[model samples]
Target: MDELSVKASSLGDNLSAPDGSDLPEPRRDFHDEQYLSQCSLKSRDLLLLTCPNLGLQVCWFLLMSSGTPYLESLDISKSITSLVWLTGPIFGAFAQPIFGILSDESRHPWGKRKPFILCGASCVATCFLALACAEDITDGPTNAPTADSDSTKHWYTQVFAIACVGVITFAMQAYQSGVRALIVDNCPPQQQAAASAWSMRWNVAGNLVLSTVGFLDAKRTFFRPEGNAKFKILAVVTTACIVVTVGLVSYYVADSSQNPRGKSRQPLTKLCWSMLCPAELSKHWNQLPPVSHRVCTIQLFAWVAWFPVLYYTSTFAYETVLPYNFARELHEKGQLDIRLIEHAELHRSSSMLYFAFATFATSLLLHMIEHAMPAFDHTQPRIWFFSQCSLGFCLLLTFFARTGATATIIISVMGASWAVAMWIPFALISAEISQPSPSKLGGKTGWILGLHNMAMSLPQIVSAILCAVILGALRWLNIGDGIAWIFRLASIAVFYSAYLINKL
Candidate 1:
């Protein structure tokens, strides 16, 4: 028998032994049968698990709400602004997998995952503080945007932003991989679906709260007076909230022992090197279960199709469709004095609110279906592919949508599908990778999760660089509707992705 099975068997033997001998019947603990029954969390545990996710969702929304505007204020051209915005995902993509591997290999008295979580939270908080302080350091006598703008430019602001994203990404990967492993370790196989459901529910709850916050922040009152100062205050407050919530959850949630006394094995590194080497890549390549390889390939393609559309959608709606529609309406009504920026902000806020509601409603519907039927077992890869295709198609429709209301509805539908696409494939990949095993349990778990993150991150980097190039090229061509090219390219990618998913 392998290590875990042997250890479990030994424990069973010790517990059931007729002992008047070496081991007397261990005094029955308070958790006899009743506690065990109660421990298997039903729907309630899922809801509680989502608390940490809520904090994360808020941080994400806040970042998305302000990031582009903040970049624009830096006096950078629109094209370069898009490129600079890519710094977060590029750094985060590299950082997350390494952290995941480290979490897998770590051995500490407190636990392997908790240390990373605390470190990540601390880093994110520090970054937000620095970002908040940027204007204070740069403000000058005339208060005309500074002469030493390049020198006075808060390099630290960008540094902190990248750092905060890196740490958060690291912490997220570690906590998710470790906690999901912990669930598999502690609970029976039958209960895993419930755990997955709970995790998704928490994600939706967090998204809902963040979306609401974004909507409120878009109001004139919030952005009009002392705009920079107000945003900094909000950032600091939200960062603290995330750190505290994640910290508490990590602390209280029990971690399964990394190596049971008699069951401990060689370190993960030694095993990984011995089993998976360049020389042996072909020999052992086929050893991995076919299902896992298929899922990973499908995931990579789906992300490539999805992320460009998502990252650019808000900007497109605000800059292109909204301005055109508002300007046309004003011209028709003979009121030519409407401010473009103010109108754009309103449209942006409205779109965010609508997207939020649609996402929450869809999540609720999916949850109810899972609760009632409990076996909504569609193939995840197929579902994820179709969702991404749908998003691309919807985005393409925006190019031709004549009415503002129709465009808004199309964008909202795309947003909702994108939200579902993000998590479902991840959930499936996590389930597939964490399947019961004898050898290299920790290493396999970490590698699978790390690869999954890499898939998500790499696509963002490509999208950022490619989109900037496309936009720049289209602008050079004087194609007034340059943004439409982006949506069309995304549709083509999605169709390619659909083919890849079908092959898988």
Candidate 2:
């Protein structure tokens, strides 16, 4: 037996022994069952568990909402922008699971999760800061937009920027997986649902903040910075928030060393090798519980439809809707207006803000529904199916949208799927794997979660590959000013995901 089981067995024997008979209800008071099941956390602990998510979400939103737009402003080709954006998902595909396995086996004095969390947060902040000033920092010949230089120097700056983004993306994955594992470690099995609910709530809060900042920044109301300068300012704000929030979480949360339930860890080298070689990890994947199997399948299909919406929405809006409107208004004058580009930026930011609000509102409604009818559980496969259908419908609606407002409204409706997509898979998976039972071998929690995360990573890789194809083999289908068909494909994938959820 493992140490946890041994201790529990010893406690049971002592409590029921003759000398202890005088003690009233020793079994009730001293049983390990009660101790493990009743490990309820206070509100303060929940807040600590959630703060890092706030910072991380802020950074994530800023990057996702702004990154490609910033690149496009520099007149970078769409293909190159997608390639730059691909860096994060590609790196994260390896990084999250690897970090997860490493943290699982970690015996660091400061704790397994905390060290990575701190390191990741610091790297994220530093790299994000670099991105904020990428224009200023990349002094190669490419930066001089109006000046002439060898194509090599210009490409050098672009490559450097992409590299920085890749590093930041990799670091954020480490921070994300670490925080997720820490929450799993701290919460007992029974309370995990509540923990996940609160987690979703906090995530919405972060989105709200992110959207508000994005809206304000786009209007240039929050800062005087023009062009990419505004992103630089936002980057500063993002860095400070991550540093302070992650620092507080690190200082306040106790180390995992204080809790021992599992067996000796596998050698780090073995885990590393397994991650590097699919054959080594395939057994673990095949052996996953039925519920995990279901959740992973759902997640994989869900993201295939979701990521394109996220990565390409702003670009689509600019090319298909906003520019046309701008052209229509300027047609009478028979002159092209440069100011339309600025207006398009504002419109995209507004759309982002609306999207965030939709998520926030959907989360609140879902919470109320879950509370009023506990039978309608948040992680129910049918609920996911319905949510996916609704999201797919919204994406399909975008195909016919003739104006920015119509597109924005359609995306706002998508917030429902977005919230469920973010919340359900993790909650369902956590509930299945995070039982209080002692580990028969070392806890497989890390690798388990890592495998599920790979589902997310896979879609990104697929999307990147498809992005290249859409630009090449499918160029003729760019019927909606070059990016419309991608939405239709995403819609089909989402409906298929919903269908898969029904099977699950």
Candidate 3:
């Protein structure tokens, strides 16, 4: 038997023979409960879960995809755009952990997660609409051009937009953590990876379609000639879909009462403190099985490596590589006025299209690997180590990238590593951490997910601050010269993550 199997067997033995206790009545197997739940779920119910997640994924892609364009339309400098991108993760980082804890303790009739999902989607839609309105007003001929003019209006618009994003981000965190808990609550341990993989398929499909739509909308001006109208329309449409899908899904997949509500489960100050205390940390930490801990650590490192790349890669492409290549080519032909927007859009479309294709291919490959190696028991830490190493290697190749095609090739490889980084660790976590007994069905699943979100959020915060500083410093030192070093730093982080994952 492999290490995981041996450890699981040992756990089962320990649970079976509690120290100094009289023999108790045998309980139903956890796997049996999960099997029954899966059997009970109709095709329609499954569709409900899948559809909402797709909607959520689409919205996520839309926001990130449109962010740069929206900033450009506001007449913010490229330096400011980079800073705003970094700021997103700062707000998102704090929001996710707090929201996770809130969702865990929440007890509304709409269910713990559904309320947050609705709230989050609404907030995001509202914010996008507000931005659209701002864009329309700012770009109007009525507005006076001045040094302070752009800064003042941009600041207000950004404040509102950022606040809305923060709210939606918190909501998304609650929804994701809650949904994962729901899956663990309802699905058997053995099928967790399969279920997660299936869920991720929907996520990928949504990303492909959404990114395509955003790309087309940006390129063709589908919404209107008026600034940011497309963003508004897309936001409204996406939010409506999320609300309807989540509402229907929640209605069909009623919460199981297998885990009883305790009066002490109320979200109280004392209880919060008790949970946060270091002594309780050990108790809660001990509750996770060894495999679960390893998987979580692996996930932590994977996100640390991956999110920085995702957050900054597009910026790097547009600001650093694309400009330099296009400028050099144009300089040869004596063409000087290379509009940033035109160049940015061209590179954005190419890069996103490449990323979409890479993700689809990687997903298919992983699916096949899972099917072919059905009985393999590789741990997440090992997978994480190798993936991080791969990412680091690809990123380092950027130093040697001298042409657009070479840059695209490097970015595509980076995208593939990103694809595995996003999905694989979560799948491993689902497989490793789930309880095998119905009695401990809940099994601190919320806390585990909360910790996972925390890990993701912390690095996001760091990246935002660090990237801003690095980009700002680079701008001061002459912009063109500093871009490569930023990428090099990202590569270093990936290598460091590989090291950390190996230790885990």
Best by TM-score: 2
- lDDT (CA) per prediction: 0.56, 0.71, 0.59
TM-score for candidate 2, residues paired by index: 0.86
Question: Mind giving the per-residue lDDT tens digits that candidate 3 earns over 1-504?
Answer: 111121222112112222334225333243333222332222333345555667667766766777666667656666756655554455444445455556556666665555666676556556556655664544445456786776666676666555555555555665665566555444445556665666776677766876677667647757657556777776766666666766765665544322233423544664455446768655655566565566555555455546556655665566544555456567798876656556565565666657776877887887787778856446545655777788888877777866556666767777677667667667776666564421222455566666565556667666666767876787666556355566677777678667766776
* Position 412, candidate 1: lDDT: 82
Candidate 3: count of backbone clashes, pairs at least 3 residues apart or interchain: 1
Give a tens-digit lDDT track for model 2, residues 8-111.
Answer: 32123222322323334434332255554533455566667667877878877777887876666666777777777777777667778999888777778887
42-153 in candidate 1: lDDT tens per residue? 3333444445655555555666666566655544456655655565566445555555556555566655555665666565556556655655644434556554664555
Candidate closest to the true structure, highest lDDT: 2
* Error in Å for residue 170 of model 3: 3.0
Q: After superposition, how far is residue 353 of candidate 1 from its true place, in Å?
A: 2.0
